[model samples]
Each structure stands twice: as C-alpha cells, then as structure tokens.
Target: MGADGGTASALEQALSTYLAHLRVERGLSANTLAAYRRDLERYLAHLVASGRRRAEDVTAEDLSAFVTNLRTGDDGGRPLSPASTARSVAAVRGFHRFCSAEDGTPDPAVDLRGPSQARRLPKAISTSEVERLLDASSIGDGAVPLRDRALLELLYSTGARISEAVNLSVDDVDLEVGAVRLLGKGSKERVVPVGSFARRAVDAYLVRARPELAARGRGTPRIFLNTRGAPLSRQSAWAVLRVAAERAGLPHEISPHTLRHSFATHLLAGGADVRVVQELLGHASVTTTQIYTLVTPDTLREVYASAHPRAHD
Candidate 1:
C-alpha cells in the first residue's frame, strides 16, 4: 500500500481494532479506553505527518522523536506533564505490541521510554481528621446522611477502592462476621476485616436508609444506591467523598482514594506487617504496598526531636 492514503487508512484501522481488543478482551474501563484513544490518535497523526504510514515502517528513532515532541509541545500542542507523557507512551507501546502480534509488524516502540517522574508519597490524613471526615458525613438527617456515613465508614475500614465499594452487592457484605468481600482489579476477591465502627454504620444504613432508598427504584442487589435508587456509580461515589471532605473542612484535596491511603498508612503505623497490609489493599505485589511504609518527614522530625537526648542542640 502507498504511503499517502492507504498507509494512513491502515494505521487508523489498526487503532480501531486495538481499541476494540482493549474493550472486549482486556476489559479496560471506559475512562481508560478514552485516554488510550486520545493518546494513540495523537501518535497516528504524528506518524502520518512524518510520511510513516505503516506501523512496521516506524523506527525507534521515530518513537523517540514523538516522545520529545510530546514533552516539548512540538506537535502543535501544549507540553505534556511527565505523568501524562508516560501514559501516552504506554498507549503507543501497547498499540505497537498489538500490531506486532496480529500483523507481524515490527514494534519500534519496544525500547521507547518516557521521561521519569518522581514518586509522590500517598497523602494520608491524621486519625483525628479521618474522624472529622467520617463525622461530617453523618451530620445531616434522613436516609441520605445515613448512607453517606456508611459509605465513608466502609471505605476507610476496608481500604476498598471506590470502584470496588460501589460494585459491592448486598450479599458481598457479611456484617455478622465483621468482614466484607471486595472484588479488586482482574476480578480478584479478598475479604477484609471490618471495624466495629464501620459495621455499625453500615448496619444502620441497611436497616433504615437502604430500605427507604430501595423503594425509589426497581429492586437491585447493590449495597449502595443513589437518591433515585439506582446502583451507585463510581462518579457518584466520588461525589459522596467530595461532599464529605467539604463538610469536614479538610484543607487538602481529598479524593476517594484518600481514605484507602489513610487506612493502609494507619495500619502500618500501628505495627501491621507489610505483607498483611498488602493483602488488605489487594496489591498484587508487596513492593507496591511498600510505598506506605515510608515515614513522613513530620513523623520523622517528631520522633527525632522528642527521643534524641541532644535534639535541642
């Protein structure tokens, strides 16, 4: 096929096929697929402009130049941050791998690397702040307030991701056993111990609030439901956390994962083993869980100043 039209169409077809594979076979979420589409589209444009119509025709140098263009804004777009650039690189790499396997195209992106980024520590609120956040969720009256409180409580107590929390069925929770079954990434299941505080709050929600909310819509097995009685979406779950953070007067930007971070951090601080924390967080690797093991500068300074005999000096 010629480089002008045929090659361009081939590249576009490849991208469409790859995206369908991601959606159907890989089971990527809609948000993730959208991001991949955006990044790969940019790459396809660059390749076509450079007269490299076929995936196999591209070289490692072409891939490297594309990375530079992304970082330097040479591709008629604003400069991308390191993190965004890395995500774009990943999309391109994955696309090339798919082409190599399916079409026998050479994968020029195999050795391509994005710029390195510093690893920021997970932000964990103090226990008192956590208490304040949880309390704030319960401030208002009625079923909604009760449901909000239980959502926040369950999230903090189990270290469940917002996706996992919202996806929970009523049967997934076993209050009698003080445990919850969380389905993590790759459909893996892990049962985490529930604290008494969370168990009680969830029980209250189940007993009073859920029944009232359930009456609003068709019957469903979901544990958390919206005001309209539909199953709670990930976006709604995030909104729930955001409203709670505002009411709690928290200074930092609190996302849904903040409670999960605090849950892991506090456990490690309280002498929980790294392996145990790994299982609780449903992290496939202990190294991924080890980030929480890092001692905060504030904690380090406090320990030093108080315990060191000559700290004042």
Candidate 2:
C-alpha cells in the first residue's frame, strides 16, 4: 500500500460495503448502484486528497468543504453541473450514515442538508414536434416500423421511464381498457391510461410486427422486442428515440425522457392537477413531481412586460 492507500482504502472499503448493503439489503437497482459507485469514487478520492484516513475522522467542516470542492471544481478542476454536485453530496451523506450505523462513528454528514440544486426544468418538445417525431417513427421501411411507432407513442402516452417501458410484458398492457401497467422505482406498479392514438398504434404493432419478432424467441412475453426477438433494452429504446427525433428534424436532445417530460408538461399546461400528474408519473413524492410546475421565467417576464399598464407611452 502507498502512503495514501490506508486512508484511501478506509473510504474504499466502507464504500464497497455500503454499496453491497444497498444492492443486497436494500435491493437498489443496478443503474442506481452504478451511480452510487461513481459518486463515491469521487468522494473517496476527495477524502484521500484531503488526508482524511480514519472512519471516525470525517467532521462536518470536512463534509462541507467536500461539497464546496464539488461545486467549485472536481478533482481534475473541471466544473460539475449542479445536479452532479448534488448527487455527489447525497452519496457522501448516505455513506456517512452507513458508517455511523455500522461503526458507531459520529456522522457529520447526517445533519448537513447538502447543496441545494435549482430544479432544472425538463426539456419538452412542442406538441407539433412530438407529432412529427411520432410520425417519423412510422416512416422506416422495416417490418418493425409499427413497433417503432408504438414504442414512441407509448413513451409519450404513459410517461414511463424507458427502463420501465422496455421491461414490460404483454400482460402488462390492457388493450381493451387502453392502459399500460408500469413497474416503477422500488417495483411500485401503476397503471397509466394510454390515449386513443397510442392504443391504436400499439394494437397495430402487436398485431402486425410483434408476431414476427415473437417467432424468433418462441413465445417471449416482452411487449417490445428487438430484431433478435429479445426484450428491448434501455439503450436500444434510447437509440429508437434519437433516430426518430433526427428523422423528424428535431433537436439532438430529444431523448426518451423528453417524451415523458412532454407528457407531464403538456398535461400541466392544459390544467391537469399537479396531484394527478404525480400519480400519472408514478412519483413516490409529489415533491419529486413538482419540478414540472415551474413556469418559464422568460415567458412570464415577457407577458408582464407587455401587459402592464405602466409600459412606455
């Protein structure tokens, strides 16, 4: 071990054990666990660089400085986004809590509120742009054009995470009632209403395209299947969105989540209640869903500047 290895390994060993606890004990998803790993790697590196070595040595000032460092710059002196810094703080807090619980050390990060990150508004396409993207999905010449169209339509209609949508089984959909069941975070299930347009698109895909894909897998039950007849993965689903967006002449940032964001924002813009949006998005906390409520400041300012009676004569 090198001079810094002892301190570094102390943090590393704790991080690994905590991650294992999250994975096995808490049943955290693989994606979340991977994020925890990356965040903690940076955190542990910070501790080592600061010469912090012992499990019980982390002080509140040290924790505060760590977050400050994250905000100002990363180890390579590159600025991190507010969201990234916030996530790193969250990871550090979680690690300290684990250490306190297991080793009976004082947890400095326990009371630290972490950095307050401004809620970055989700990017949503206009209704017309969404229409174009959906239409573009059907333009491909493959046997799976219907499938591609259905996938995009379902994403917008259900406000589902791509992982939730791709993990769906045929049984998760109720065509007669026009709803799809999503297993969201923590395996919480919610049935979201599929609109008439989406229902029609999905029905056509099931009838025309799915059968051929299913033939290759010999009765696989996944709703969306790849060319190889395997269940559609998150990466492939994202690629599908990108391709459709490009074909429709949309911006490069039109991700699968953009459809979900559009679904939430459009619903709210049309006066759908925030609580209803919460339920539809399957958010565990309405607070998590409330970012959609933030209005565009530029739009609000423009309206106020134009409509006020005190405007320039």
Name the weakest run of 10 consecutive residues (lDDT summed) in model 1: 295-304
Candidate 2 lDDT, tens digit per residue, 26-59? 7788889999998888777777777788657877
Best by TM-score: 1
Clashes of 2: 0
Clashing pairs in 1: none
Clashing pairs in 2: none
lDDT of 1 by residue, 112-179 (tens): 88899998799899999999999999987899999999999999999999999999999999999999
TM-score of each model, paired residue for residue = 0.88, 0.85
Top of the candidates by lDDT: 1
